[model samples]
Every structure is written in structure tokens, then in C-alpha cells.
Target chain A: MLRSESEAELAFRREVRGWFERELPAELRDLTFRPLPDMVMPWYRKLSRQGWIAPHWPRAFGGMDASPVEQVILMEEAARIGAPEIPTQGLNQIGPILQRFGSDAQKEFHLPRILNGDAIWCQGYSEPGAGSDLASLRTAGSVEGDDVVVTGHKIWTTWGHHADWMYALVRTNKDVPKREGISFILIDMKSSGVLRRPIRTLADEFEFCEVFLDKVRVPRANIVGELNRGWTVATALLSQERLILGSPGNALRAYERLRRLARALGTRLSDSDKLMIAKARIELETLIASFLDAAEGFRDGRPVDSSYLKILSTETTQFILDAAQTVSGAYAGVKFPMDVDGTTIDFSELFLQSRRLSIYGGSNEIQRDLIARNVLAMPRGRA
Target chain B: MSEIAGDQMLISDNVRRLFDASRALPRARAAAACWPDTDRTVLREFIEMGWLSLLLPEDDGGMGASAIDFVALIESLGDLLLPEPVGPMLATVSLLAACQSPAADRLLKAALGDERIVLAATEADRSLQGDTNHIVFDAHWADVVVFATGETEQFSLRAVAKIDVDGLDALVRNIDGGSLCSVRLDGSMGEELASGARARDIFMRCRNMQRLAAAASLLGLVRKSLQDAIDYVKLRRQFGVAVGSFQALQHRAATLHVACQSARALLYEAARTVGTANEAVACAAAKVKAADTAMAVVKESVQFHGAIGFSDEADVALFFRRAVALTAAYGTAEACHRTCFAG
Candidate 1:
């Protein structure tokens, strides 16, 4: 919006802004906590019906085919309205992967359901022993007759308990290297031997869980790509997912909360508080610019080190929430949402929830290691 | 990429080659202990190449480039640690050209030729928000200083020749080995360029442009320091291994590298908003982010170099000095935050 956007873009922004303001329900406007699926799905389906869901997808795949700027506009508007966070494993990750690598039959079955919110998908990549080092995942898939029997444990599966399906990486070739032996498969969450147990987060929410798959049998045709090539298939669209993760939308929301908290307290911010807030604001602006930089690089076929973007974006969001915690003063330790005038402000909920930003997707430590090795070409230490 | 971006890259490449061949750092070091003076050979080459007139109107013997292009040029200069006061000089002339006054025209001509007419500020022009603090940058090299005075919406531009100024302090050596001077201009022998709202509007525009240029330069400084540190860590061994191979140093370097890139992206994006309505906030944000990033990079870069980085002989030390001055130039990070949040 600051860069002298085109007339059409401005008009488009105005349109999106108006639609969000008018259509978003009052109950959903600015929740301090993550709304459960039952409370948020209607809104999600509304967006799907409005043809705004999966803005990054192609129109041929039941998506809006949004341009990058249009996609940014959509995100900005959603953040403007404080839209509820929806399950996005289907939209951000698997939808694109399936578009690229799924069989025609799989596309015909899953794409429409994903768009219409009939299906909720959770990624099944990280196992008990393979969080950051995902290549070492030991989820076994032994083909027996027409079925591939899957068995293993997957941790940190977001929305796994409520998901209708799980896209997974399973070891199909035991003798090969860890990464090379894997295969990508989709499984029904309701299938026998598949069990989900929600793990409580530090934020005190059941946002993610661990799933135990014990000899779950799935049709061999459920495989997305070639056997022993799940590593390639899973990583094919990671840069795009990282790009979405690296957007400044979350940081903007966090900064808005910080500003609101400062205003609600009705006290003069000390010099140090002001300085921290300013630093956060400045970092948010830089994150916005870097998102554009990487997106532009992506469009130009230039090498966009999405790892750097992910680190900057996620860490900046964390930094802002940290600032908010500082500004919260005596309210910093408050456990529940406090009514500051007409608004309910949770001083610690966001501060606690944001801790996951640096830990999930890929830990910031892993991201830093990747950047050091790939971008800087630093030597691998002889272990 | 568009043709303009292609042209920018070409311009950046040429500028890099020029600085690379000119032994810029050595010359800067040689002039550090001397009175405020830049290499005339390098300055003359720069002027002859029309860099000083980059922001002037095409009708005024210049290319009429946008602030984005100006940022491109300044960033390259900063990366090589060029000793000349080219950035300030360019900003000074750009302001003059925008004024469209006879006095401004005369000063612009002198600046584009050989004289160094750097931008200055007095206490009266609060619009710049405590940028100068009564201390003028590159004052030792200035043949004249152009300042804006009067109230916020009623500013007036004035030019004072360095020789006629009274109560001007002797050139103080800066951390970057540049020259700064405390001046008390009592309005003696000063020529007014314009008055009232016209001057105020032009002055604000010039300030935004200058902020963008400084931010771009600070980002350049950060990139150089970060790259140098990265290179050093790979070559320097510790515990019978390259220091860069250590997770601690690698993570630290990676973090700094991200900061450098993020600030740079902000700088370039902010440069594009120069003439837009959002220019003020965008420029302020860019300046604050770049300044903070530069400080972080320079500090960590010194650590990466170990004790050798603290020595005067190390170019990283010079970069630290330059970052310190430049970060304070347009506005300190605190002052800029006040301006941004207040707006």
C-alpha cells in the first residue's frame, strides 16, 4: 500500500477491505485465542464460497489464481479484520503438492473437497525421532497385496485430532539411505489403527498432537508420487510454503496487539519501552519488504533463500510479541484475558502462542544451520 | 526484470568496478588524519561522471533520476567505503534544484563542478527532527552549507559561504575519520533561496530523499561488514577447526546475514516510495531498520574477527565508525521512531 500501487490494485484492496468489514461476524472479529473448528468453519466456508480460499492456487484447481500482489492484498485484508486462523495444511502445503504430483484421480477427489472445506488435512512428516532431521523418519509402509500397510508415530501434527486425512512420508525401501527410502502416501484419519492424542502446548491450547499409526492399511494407489521418492515430492513446494510462512501478516497482527495494549494501559511508555516498540515496528516494516523481495525473486526465477525469509519473518513476529510482553507491565504475568475498556486483552496468550512460531515449521536453529550451510557455504564440521 | 532494474544493476556493477580500481579504502585511510579533505582525483572522476547531478532535473544538466536510482548509486559508494562526501553533496544539490531559485542555482553549479556544498540544519527546522543537532557532517570539506530555517510550515532555505561564517568550530575528527563541525550562524552574509510553504514542501521532500539515501548506505555498510565477517570466520580456525564450522558462530553469522538482507530489502522498497504520499513513514522506517541492522552487524563482525577487529588497521573497524556516524546522520533511531509513531 505504501509503494504507490496501481489504480486497479487500490480498487481491489478497497473491495477486499469492504467485504471483510461487512461480512466478518462480530463474534469472530478479534478473538485473542485460536477459535475451535466448530466456531470457525462457517467463516472458512464463507471465504471458500466467496472464491477467496486458496488464493495462491490455480483457477483450474478450484482456486482464485491470485497474483502475488493480490495474494498479499488478501492477507492484509484478513489481518485487518483479525480473521480467525484456519487449518491450512491442505491449502498451503498439500494442495500445491497434489497439484504438482498427484495423480489425475487423486486431484479429482481431493481438490474440490479441500477448497470447499469438506476435508481437513494435516501433514504427517515429522516422526518421534525426526523433527528437524525429517529425512530420518522411520514410518514404515510395507506393500502387501493391493495395500500399503503404514505404521509409525508422528508428533507435532497440527490439527491432527480433527483432520479428515493425513499426507505422510513413509519408509518404503529399508536398505536405501533414509531420505531415498521414503514414499509419500495419504491416509484416512478414521482408518483403523490410526489414533490421535492432543498434546497441550505451553500456551495451554490443544493446537497440535501426536498420531500413532499401527499397521494402517491404505490402497497402494493412495501414493502421490513414485515409491522411494517421497523426499522429493514432500520438498517440491517447500519454498512456496516457506514463502507463505515468511509473510509479515503475523507480525502485523502482533504489532497491532502491542499498539492496542499500549493504548489500553493509558500510561506513558518509558523511553526503553518506546525504544523496544519502535524496534519491533521497524522490524515489521523490514519483514514486509523482505517478503516482497523474496516473492519478486521467486517470480524472476532468481534464487530466493526462503530459509532466510523464514528466520526473519518468524523471529520478527516473536520480537514484537516480546515487546508486547514488556509493555504489558504488571499485566505481563496475567494468565487470562483482562477487560481493558470494551476489549479483552490477553497479555500472555499471544506471548505464549508465539513461542511456537520459532519452533514449528522448522525450528529457527535448523533454519540458521541451513542458511549457514547453503547461503554462506560454511564448512560442515567433521563429527 | 524490467529494463529499469536491469539498468540499475548495470549502474551498480560499473560503480563497483570504479571503486574497486580506485583503492578507495587506502585513500580514505590516508586522508583520515589530515584536515577534512577527500581525494580530489576520485571526487573529480565522480563529478565528471555526473554523479553529483544525478537528482537534478534533466533541464539542469542532469539525468533527472528518481530517488531509487540515487539510492542505487549511494549504496555502491558506501559498500566500498568511498571517502568523498558524495551522498551529502548529491542531497544538497538535489534540494537546490528543487528550490528553483537563482541563489540555489549558483550553489548547485559550484557543487556540480568541484566545490563541496553539504546539507546543513539549524535548530529552527524541527521537521528534520533533531537530525543535525547543530553539528554539520563533512563540514571540513564544505565550501558552503545550505540550511533550512523558520517554523515547520514556513521554512526558508539559506546559503552561507564557509569563509564568512562566524563562531564555527574547528573540524573535529569523526569516528569514521570524517569531519564534523559545530556552527553558529547568526544570519550574516547568508542568501535566502525561497520562503514560506514552497520552501517547507521542498525541504520535507529533500529530507525524505536524504533519509532514503542514508538508509541505503547504512545497509551497504552492514552487508560489507557481514560479508567480511563471514569470509573471516571461514578462514580463521579455532579448536583445530574453522570457526565458521561451529554452530554458535554459524548461527550468529546467519542471523546477521538475515538482518542485512531484510534491511536492504526495506531500503530498496522505501526508495521506490520517494514521491508517494507514504514516503515520510516509509523512509523513517527504512532508516531506523537499516541503522539498527548496521550497528548489530558491525558489533558482531568485530567479535567474529576476534582481537584483530579492534585494531585501526582492520577495514571492519572503519566500517564500524562509518556506521556510527551515518546511523546518526538522518536521525538517530530513537528520534526516527518518535517521528514515525507520532505521524
Candidate 2:
């Protein structure tokens, strides 16, 4: 029943575009901040209060329950406005998972906090041993009466330092298959025996943390879905993560930065440079079309595959970042003050940050292998 | 011209159906293997369908369409790896269109239907310049011979075998194993349509037009390659999922798609701009962009296809070879880059 958009969609696009141009804050115009989670929290609250934080959530859960097309429109508007990157573990991953699979009481408690921006969440799925091969995670949790005692280390927990809660996959039945033995459990990060250590990355950013749980206790009611079926929950969350990961905000910001740097330097763009810009423009256009196609697929109740979007959006971000570095030249490495907010940043930091585009939310290499074997239906390489 | 005119979809459902039918024909492949001269039956079919005369003037028994039309038709052909004389035939018609001689008129008329004529532009020992040489060939089988040179000048008709040159076979071999011969022109057998500097002008324009058409054809080939890859990725599953579901391959396909689209947009722009006298630089830029993008897409399409794409029997490799050869044929990307950017 879901067909390509009627004229209504075009009108929606225009309205969204108009609103973005008018309401997007000046401080969010460029990638001038090391966009930390704390710096973005206030804006998150603003969007939450406006019921724009979780566009696809059911209306009953303080969300717009937007159609797939509307969800895309929201993301496009957010990118166009250079909206600050809100910490999304709560809004993007946890809240939706809870609404779909969690007990009513669990959703009653967590969904409101997420909608109010009163609680922040971080994923506790990837352990030191289980990155990529997530089913191999050794995190263990035992049900003890009204509580579950969990003990595991979750690595690469983005913004773990600021999160209020963590949803994790822990082994509940070790004798079962590696995937079936897992249980999804939510833990209060502030609970006793929960420890967090920041992991500094090459970009000199500590956006991720190593979270160690030594017998941390979570309420039994916090377990999502059936026991030892955590893999499905984890898989669902990962699908959401991949979709969010494929968003085009970073590339849009990079383009804005490129234009700003070009203007600041007063450098006359060569025809080739103009051609590059033209190509970038066309890339953006194509990406939008592809995204729309994907959204239509999602809205039609078909399984939404994020492979194409993730690959394209991430590479485009990297390309734009690379172009920005080229445009910035010698000053690319030098940090500059944000014109609106007085924060210092540099193209170098941006370039370093862009490196993660292909790594997190499943490495691009893994994505490529998926595409080759799954999409192309080529024979698998001999191990 | 309306800006929206450029956005008109080049690949329509009808064209796609035509390609599907053409690709299914066993005779098309056999005809392609024959090279320069395609099967007379196939040629007649194409001519009757108006594809062969797509760019000729309507009054001259042809379509009188623009370069964009020519590009759309040629790209469909490239997708099928149809080894028709579309390129040389189109180039010959273009050359005749640029000339005013009685011979040019006669050749143009013949080229619109069953008649075939090959252009001899690449000279031996000329170090890769695409200009037509003074050397002639035997006119015994030729209904007309176009001798073009430079921009804004007329083309003279020289009888085949009237010009003196060595290594014509090598030049012909370079152009997809087509037959070509070299000879000395005594200036006695052919009538001059334009002499001196004017002749040079006409010749350059003709060469540029040929190069532009070749680039367009390559663009078509690249686009088809991408579509082939896309179709393969969509249903091909691995590890319990479609391979296209993997982010890595998706990224590669996406990047290739962007490159192909960029080439297409530029090609359309260039074709539209070709009518304007001052758009020479723009056309050159388009040529460089389209040729480079086309070659890149075709090569990667083969690579992405893995073992199946590399086999000689696979239709993709044919497109790959055509793209590689065409990229170097007209003017190299480097030459176009320099020309467009030159002050």
C-alpha cells in the first residue's frame, strides 16, 4: 500500500525546510565545538519538550509517531539546521527498545524520563571480547529473587560517563547456543560496583568509556523480552543504531565548514574545486533520494536495511571532511573560536572524528563483507 | 533552453525494454565479434528503427536530434555491448554535417540508412593526437570521403588511396581491429571543399565532436555497470542477509553510484552547452569528468563483480575494455583538464 510520496510529501519537505531555516540556532551552524554530550543536553531537552526528540515513537509515549517519510523529514531538517548532536542512547536506542519489548512497568518508568531528558542511557552490549562478534559476549547476570546480579565489562560505551543507565546483554544460560544464552538487562550506572574508565581515542576525544560491572544489581523487572533471548533485543537495538549512524548530519556540517573556511580565507575556488563542490552537491542530492527510498521501504512495513544508507552517509561524511581539510589548508590543524558560541575547534579534530564514521555502529569493513556476501551473493572467501 | 530539459530522464522504460530485447538477441553478439562492420541485418534494423540516424538532420533522412539524444541511444547500446558501428558511423555523419562539399552531402545521405563509412582520424606516429592526417585511403568502396580539419572550416573530399602514409593498419587495429589503410594524396583525385586555415577549423570541430560522442557512450556503459551491480546486490544474500545489507559493500556501491551520477549530470550539461560557441571549455570539462567517471565506474564494476566480472565471457568486461579504450581515444583526461583550465 505504501507508494512513493504524493504532492503532500513535497509540501511537507518545503515546510520542514522553511522551519529549519528559521528555527535552527546560530550556535549550531558549524562544527566549531568538540560537540560534547553535555553541550548537547539542553538542545535535546528543547527538542524533547517540543515532541521532536523521538519522531518515530508511538504517540502515546510522548512522541509524534511520525510516518517514515516524516521521520526522514525530521532528520533532514535536523541536519540542515546543523542541530547539535544530542546524546542518543536514550532517545534513539533504549526508549524504542523498551516500548517494543519491555514490560509495561519498565516502559512506564523509563520512557517518561527519556522523553523528559531526565535520564541518559548508554549501550552495554559490546564487551572487551565480543566486539563485532557480539554473540560471544561473556557478560553474566544471575536472577536472584527480585534482583539480578550482573558482572561484566562493556567497552566502547559512548558517553558512559554521563549516562544514567545502561542496557546490556549478559549471559543467562551458558549451556545454550552463544546467541541464545544471552539476556538483555538494564542497570543503573550509579549503582554500587559500577565503574567507568574513559578511553581516549586518536582524536584526543574521550567520547567512549570502558564500563566495568562487578556484581552490579539490576531489578528483575528491568530484563527486556524473554530470558536467554537477548540476542533478538540486541539485534533490534543494533538495527536502530545502524540506522541512526547512517544519518547525514556530519557531512552537512562538514560542507558548512568547507564553505565557511572558503569564505574566511577568501581563496578563489578553482574550476576543479568548483567541480568537486558540484559533485558533493550531487552526492548529497543522491543520498537524499536514497534515504527517501529507504524511508519508503520502512514505512511500508518492510524490513528496513541500513547497509546502503550507512555506507553512503558515512563515506560522504568522510569525503566532506577530507574536502574541508583541503579547503582549510595550513590552518586545518589550527583550532579556531566558534563565531556564535566562542568554542575552539579545528578541521584536524573534525578529520580525526570523521575516522570513526566507518568504525563505530559496525566497522565499514564488516559492512563491506556483509554487502559482498549478502548483497552481491558472491561466494565467500576461504578463511 | 529550459533547465528542466536537462533533467528529463534519459533511461526510460521503453529504452530499458529495448535494451533487454537487444541483449537477448544472439545475433547481436555475433555481429559485435565481427567488429567495425556490424551485421547488415542488424544495421538495417537499427537504421529502420531510426537509431543509426539519431543525430543526422531531419531533411537528410535522420532524426536531427541533439547530442543528449545521441548519448542516450549510445549508452543503451553500450549497456548491451552492441558492437555496432554506432561510433564511427555517428562520427562520419557528424563530419559530413560539418562539411559543405557535394561529396559530404552524398556521404551524409548514404550514412542515414544502409551505407557504412569509417572515419580515418588517428594517424600513425602522431604521438596520440586525434587529428585527421593528410594520408588517404582507397576510395574504391567509398561513396564519399570526408577530409576535415580545424574549427569553422569546410571539409574536402579526397578519394581513398589518394593520400600517402604508412602504418594505417596499426591505426585501424588500435580502433577495435577495424580495417584502415594509408596512402599518399597527390591532390589530383579529390575535390577541395575548403583549403588553407578554414579546413583546419572544420577538422578540429569534427574531432572534438567524435571525442564527445565517445565519452557519452562510455558514460552509458558506466551507468549500466552500476545498475548491474545494484541489481546483483539487492537480492544476493550472505550470512543470512543480503550482501547489500553489509555496510562496506553498500558504501562501495554508493560511492560508485555518486561517481556515475556526477558523470551523467556533467555529460548532460556539456551536451546542452555544446551549442553555445563559448562553451568549449565547459564541454572539455564535461568530457574529462564523464570519461574519467565512466572508466572508474566500469573498472570498479568489474572489480566489484569479483571473478564473474573478470571473465571474458561476462558482458561487463566488454564494457570495461570499451571504457578503457575510449578514455584514451579522443583526448586523454589530462588533455581535457589542461584544455578546459588553460587561460
Candidate 3:
């Protein structure tokens, strides 16, 4: 029976901790408690340059190929040291999916650019009509000999304006099942017909964009997996995306901010608050164990199940955020008049950001349905 | 960053297999018995497997395993509903280990086989504080009797008559309210092993270990009950639909599963912290969460089974009763909160 971490693993953890303490930017640490201007990408590029972009990615793809346990340690240390949240649509979502299902030439072209931080990716997944019912997408991608003619409207495209490339699921066969006829296609956002319009959110920030694809031409080689079978590839990508969405850093960071705010507000730590804190602590611990179980399952060559992670992570994040808002009370709605360095804290932004968490990367309702149908093997509800 | 040594996994695997094999034993019937006793053969098997010696130092002819190892063992034991004083015995061993008394080594060796020792920590008043009215069970079966005095500063060991609580039932009815009483002794008894804050620390450490072990056991019970309910609902049909096919029941089962997983993690984490100074607070939290979760899950298991679950003959009811009884053991939820607030 394995007892504790081996001496070698402990040493490895120490080294990683040391490097994080010495090398992680101070601004990243400050941003953990207060949001920084969205120009933190340069620091992200630094980490990517250091070959720490995807700690679990295979070495052949310019990754460290760290063990699952090692990756956990890295994540824990990174969270502890308040590493900047790398805008990771490419590293977390597209990179992994492409690695798994992309063609040889596609990998050869994009993997290096992704490693060098030369190419940024955004997801063109949800649409006006197909937010939750993503498979019912009306986005069209018709074969045009050497190029695929794509004409569609994509909404809630996160970081769309900054992205160099866009990955989308488009309807390729109109007569087939909604899920079966979709194709996962990659498109250059710089294409002449691609238009991006930013959308303002409750946070009073334009963090997402709506992209209109007017006869955008995507090469045939840009298709991930096969035509009309993109649902499987998309589903797999969504599974990994769900895991990324469920990471604990955001919740932990929010929790720390909540504690600081509570202290600042001079609120006595009530028994209810203490119990809530304890519950949050225990919830995090449980999530860590379940995360380890999923990681170990993957490492041991078993198919990783994301249902448990999805349910717990999403719900727990919302629960923590709700608790924070309750604890912060009136101050939670204080709006920052300007981009002050540290004087004015905007709790309202956190409140608004939290609302998007349960909605994005597949809504919590859809996650619950997926958990019921896939993990629990529950029969579908009657129409 | 730490790689786990393979020994822990090996021990866990062995214990898991042992637990799985023992689950085939007639649990519903045995658990229904007023004083369901563990088979002597199984006890011997556990001893031979070095499970009982998991916490004892290797110099004392034991494995010198950490507290987490014992937790795994306790979890396995609880999963099978194994009726043994494993918690009490491990408590005694932990106390002895902490004290480092010369007698601890000799006594631990004797405790490896037929020797049975139960800690007499409970009092009639149900206060967590130690009492002088220590009740040693079956002295003939025990080579030593470790007792703590009310002063919280002294522990006196004596050769005394073990009270015969055989007809009184092996499984105490009110675990929360029960008292352990042997014939009273006057003056400073036989031998003084350790005293003062040192002794009190050792005693409290033992109590915390027992609490954590019991919590882990309850976690196993919760797991078993939830799994049983799930399996039952999947097979048993109602209104031309499998009971599990109903969203209402499935939701209930999933909720219970979440609670069980939460409680399980708390128990394991608490167990990992046992014997340290933080053990009291951690153990209190673990016991409260695990006991409450176990009780609710087992009760739901019974309710979910319908009339068949209500009968004493049914295994669901058996688990329900055990969960109820165990919840009050070690300490009540309120008492745990008090302990947590004590610091």
C-alpha cells in the first residue's frame, strides 16, 4: 500500500514550489485578489515559453508530460502562489482536442504555433438558437472542392476578438440527426468574411464576442476527425473542456478574497460563516480526491469520466460565490468608478462573473442531465 | 509531487479483498442479532494479516503503520459490518504508543491474539471528561487494564475484576448514554504508568483515534447502504418501471452519494491528522459529519426499500439500526461542536 509521497516526489514538489515563488510575476499574485487589466497575456506567454503551458501534455507536443499526480502538485502550487489565469482556450481546449483527433499536417502546423504563443484560439460553439442545444446548430459548412464555405452566426465566443483562430461545430448534413451531421472545423479569424462584434455582460465588460461567418473559407485539412461524425469529436472536446472549466483555482481565489473582504468589513465570524467555511474546505478536499480519481483513471489507461467532476465543480463554485456575496452584503455591489490600482474593489464584478461560470462550458443544467444520463445511466425523460 | 510508496496500496488492496470476501457472510441475520459477535476465525484472520498491529511499533512485533493505514483498515471493516471491538483495541494501542511506557511493548504483544482490551472512556453523565469509575471488560481476556482518573492528570493501572456485561448485550443500546463500570477501587491502585498532562494527552489522543476510526467505519456503512439502495432500485420493478428509472428516486440516491463521498473524504482527512495536537478538532468535525451522513443515508435506504426495509429481517433496517447506534457513539454531534469550539 502506498503510504505518503516518496522522497523523490517531495523533492520535485519543493523544486516546483521554489521556482513558482521565485519566478511567478508579482502582478499575477495581486490579480488573484483583484482583477488586473486583461493584458496579462504577456506573462502567460512567458510560462508557455518556459514549456509549462500544458503540464500534462505529451512531450512530443512540446509539453512536460508530467504525471497526473505531478500535474496535481503543479496546479496546487500554482494556485497557492496565485499564478495568473492563462487565457487557455488554446492550451486547455483546442490544443488537447487537436492532439487527440487532428490530422498530422494540422498538428504540424498549429502545435508549434500554440507552443510558441504565436496562435491564440477561441471557441465558436454556442449560437443564438443553439446555446444549450448546441447540436441543433444552424451553422453551415458546405464542401467547396478545396475549401469549405462556412456561413454561420456564433454567439458568446469568449475572447473572440483577440483570438487568431476559431474552432467551431457546424452542420454539414441537413437531413441527418442533429448530432450526427455536425462537423468540427477550424477557421482563421482573420479571414475576410469573419466579423466580430463584442457583447457587454452584467459585469459591464465586453469579454465575449458574437462572430458572423459570411462565406468564410476554411481549408478541407482544417476539419477535425471525419465529416458528419463531429459529434463524437465535439463531445470528447467538451469533456476535456468541462474538466478545464471545473478547475479549483477560481473558487479558491474567490474564497480568499471573501475572507479578506470579511475582515475588511469587520464582520464577526459567525457560527454559520464558520460552518460554511468548514464546508467549503471539506468540499475542496473532496473535489481534490475526486479529481485525483479521474486523473488516475486516465493515467491507468481507463476512460476518464467527467460527470462527477462537472457536477461537483460547477455547483461548488456557485455555492462558494453565493456564500461570498452573502458575506460581503452591501459592499459586494460597490462599483469601481475607474481602473484604480487597489483603492476601489469591485465585488459586483465577481458576482456577475460567477453567474457566467454555471452557464459557460455547458450550462450546469446540461451538466446535470449529462451526469444523469451518462454516469448514472438514467433513462431519458419522456418528451 | 510526491509519489506514494507502493506499500500503502498493497495493504489497501489486501484489506479490500478481505472486506469483499467477508461481505458474503450472512450480514442481515447477523446484524439483526442483539449482540452479533464477530466469528473467532475472522478475528484470527485479521490478526494473522497484521491488521491489529498496524499502529504498534515494529519493535513491539507490529507493522508501525501510520494512522492513515489504520483508517483504510477501519473503512474496510466498516464496509463489511464486521462486529469487532477494532476501534476500542486500536484506541488502546494508540494510547500505549503515545505513552511509550515499557509495559506498552509487552502489552501490545499480548494484544495481538486472543487478548481483548476495550477503553473505558464513557461515563454515566456522558461527559467527555474521564472518570475514575473505569470498567474493564473480561479481565481474564485482557492482560492489562489502562484507566484514567477524573483529575485529568493521572492514569492508574490495577489488577481488578472485569465486569461481566455478557448478558447486558455486546452492542450497547444507547451508545451515547452508556457507562462502562467495573468494581470500584480505592486509593492509588496497582501500578502508575504515566500521569499529569502527559497522561491526559495520551488519553485524549486515544479518544481522538477512536473517534476518527468510528467515523471512517460510518463512512463505509454509508457507502454500503447507498450502494445497496442503488442496486435494489435498479432491479426491483414498480408500476412497470424499474424503481431506479424514476427521477425522484435517482435524485435521492445521487444526493446520498454526494453526502457519503463528502463524509468519506472528511473522515479520511481527519484520520490522517490523528494523534497530532490538531486531532481533537479534526476528529470532532469528522465524527459529526460522518455520523450524521451515515444515519441519514441508512434511514433513506430503509425508506427507499418500502415495507421490506422497515422489517428487522431486512438488511437495510439492520444497517439503519447500526448507523443510528454508531452516531451516538464516540460523541454526539453537539458534543463534537463543543470540542471544535473549545480551542
Give the least accurate 10-residue stretch of model 2 chain B, judged by summed lDDT. Answer: B1-10
Q: Give the CAPRI class of candidate 3.
A: incorrect
User: Which lDDT tens digits does candidate 1 get at residues A7-79?
Assistant: 9988989999998999899999777676888988888899999899888788889888776677778877887
In Å, residue A263's CA in model 1 sits off its true spot by 3.0
B1-343 per-residue lDDT for model 3 (tens digits): 1122466567656765754545633643454453334345655666678777678778867788777777766776575555555666777766766666666555555656546553434322243324433333322224345666646444443222234233222222332222233434433554454677787777777777777877877887778778787778778887777777776776666666656655665566566656555677777777877887898898889888889988766677656766776777666665676666453
Error of 1 at A224 (Å): 1.4
DockQ, in order, for the candidates? 0.66, 0.08, 0.21
Q: Candidate 2 residues B180-283, lDDT tens each?
A: 43433334545554555655555555555665666677776777777787666666666877555655566576556545554555555555545555345545
- Tell me the spans in candidate 1 whose CA falls farther than 4 Å from its real position: B1-22, B115-118, B122-133, B186-189
Provide the DockQ value for model 2. Answer: 0.08
Q: Lowest summed-lDDT stretch of 10 residues in model 1 chain B?
A: B122-131
Give the per-residue Cα lDDT of candidate 3 at B267: 67
Per residue, candidate 3 scores C-alpha lDDT tens digits across A25-72 of: 776673532232255667667778777777877898999888666766
Best by TM-score: 1
Model 3, residue A29: displacement in angstroms? Answer: 4.3
Clashes of each: 0, 39, 8
Q: What is the interface RMSD of candidate 1, in Å?
A: 1.9
The best candidate by lDDT is: 1
